[model samples]
Target: MTRLRSAAAALALSAAAVLPIAAPAHAESRAEAQVNAFFGQYRDAVLGQNPNQDPTDVREEFMTSELNTELDQWAADHDADPVFRAQNVPSGWSVAYGGSGAGHSTVILTEYWAGGGHTDVWYQVRLDTLRIDGLEDAPQ
Candidate 1:
């Protein structure tokens, strides 16, 4: 009888422990959703527009958001105009991939040249961990 009680008690304890693990702390928050939405909007803006100034221009690219003006200015400074030309390929895409990590919505993206020729990558950025200026560090 004593053995039976002990076994049942252990089983109950184990079951209690297991149940909490089944559920996460909570659902993803509104902040996470908002951050992901922002990333999606930026990505769409990049992909939807023509990267080249002229259709005939062999190569061109542009990323005009204040969020990342440094890189845009850098491209302009160099001989390489932000342009890529191909029949059907996107000249450049602000490819943003979002995931939840460290209790935050994180993003990693690249300014990619079509056909995988070249890319300028950004590290992961976490939501709820941004500065006052709305910039988040890219997670390693």
Candidate 2:
């Protein structure tokens, strides 16, 4: 009887371990969503990571707002025409976020086709305002 009880208890414990549990969502409407949307748009614009891997050969573009804004300012400063700028500027990227806290986050991205290797992007988000204070490759 003792051995039978021990076996039954073990089985019960194992079953509990495999049982699924409900959990709340995180990053659904935050930085994480932003990252996902960026990549999804990228895949749509170019046949990304498919038969035509790294499709920047056709055109260049950035999926992040921060980078886009910076590029626009640079173009304005240089008096660069839009068509010429698009053909020469860096584009096509993938990102991996490091850690996120109350107001700060880190994202590492592949910068191969963008003219170099990989880069780590840092971000400051104001949760209260639900807005990104800033984002850049180097520390701000």
Error of 2 at 110 (Å): 6.6
Q: Please give the lDDT score for candidate 2.
A: 0.49
User: lDDT per residue, candidate 2, 46-109, as tens digits?
Assistant: 4344454343322233333554566467558767522123334335555566677766554444
Instruction: Tell me how far the alpha carbon of residue 128 in candidate 2 is from the true structure, in angstroms, after superposition.
Output: 8.2
lDDT of 1 by residue, 1-140 (tens): 99999999999999988886555554544544443444444444445553433322211121224434543455466644222212233344453445556654443434445556544334333354441112333435
**What's the lDDT for candidate 1?**
0.42
Q: What is the lDDT of residue 90 in candidate 1?
A: 39
Off by over 4 Å in 2: 10-27, 42-69, 73-118, 123-133, 138-140
TM-scores, all candidates, are: 0.33, 0.37
Best by TM-score: 2
Q: Candidate 1 clash total? A: 9
